[model samples]
Target: MHEQNPALGLVHVLRAVTVEFDLLGAEFAARHGLHPTDVRALIHLLDATRAGTRATPGWLGEQLRLHSAGTTALIDRLERLGLVRRSRDTADRRRVLLEVEEKATELGWAFFGPVIGEVLAAAEGFEAAELETVRRFLTSVLESVGRARSA
Candidate 1:
């Protein structure tokens, strides 16, 4: 199929990539003895840490589309695994914050480093303009998926 053929080429590429990611996620979860949802919650917490932000059970529940009870249970499981810790916010004693443990953070980086390196290396083959276009395309795809989910 021609690269310019959105229906045949782009759509197939998108679908394939999505499936590949899903499979990869499942594998990662299995390796860590976690459920897929737990892996996702960990990823969200990791992302928040990288962004210099803290995640709360309430916020994580909303993000994961899980109820409060479910979120609390997930958090409890993670804590038992030594992957995460819950603490009271110093600024707000009533607020509880979830933080990824250092060992768990290291484990994630070690497991995902090769894949991340390969992705970066692949992007290095593209010119700045091409990379920018790819970024924009991915952003649009993400927005579209979010809209579809909400609908």
Candidate 2:
């Protein structure tokens, strides 16, 4: 099928990604004691550090594509484990920020090193231009789909 045949091409690519990504998530979760749901939450928190922005539960819920209740529960478990905390935003009493603790932050960073190393090794031959193109494309795709309710 050609790329112009969007439905068939997209379906094939999407299925392949879904299978591989699911396995990656399962393996990471197994090795980390983080369920698939919690792994996504951790990923959300980990990625949010790029902008030095603290996400509220609402923000994280949106980021993780979780409903309010689910986000609340996820945070609840995380907070209980001392991984994440709900802190009132000093600038606004009404704003509650979800903060990943220092220990969780350190541990989470270490946890993802292997995944990054593997991907880097796999991309070793890609030209800088090609790498940038892939980065932009993936970033755009992620931004478009990050809050999606379903795959």
Per-residue lDDT for 1-151 in model 2, tens only? 4346765676588679879878887887787677788878877787786678778998998877779999898899888878888889999989998877886767655866777788899899899999998788778777767557355
Q: Give the TM-score of candidate 2.
A: 0.73
What tens-digit string does per-residue lDDT give for candidate 1 at 44-89? 9988988987799999998899998999999999999999999999
- Off-target runs (Cα >4 Å) in candidate 1 are 1-4
- Compared with the true structure, model 1 gives a TM-score of 0.91
Q: Which 10 consecutive residues of model 2 have the lowest summed lDDT?
A: 1-10
TM-score to native of every candidate shown: 0.91, 0.73
Off by over 4 Å in 2: 1-18, 143-151
What lDDT is obtained when candidate 1 is compared to the true structure? Answer: 0.90
Error of 1 at 19 (Å): 1.1
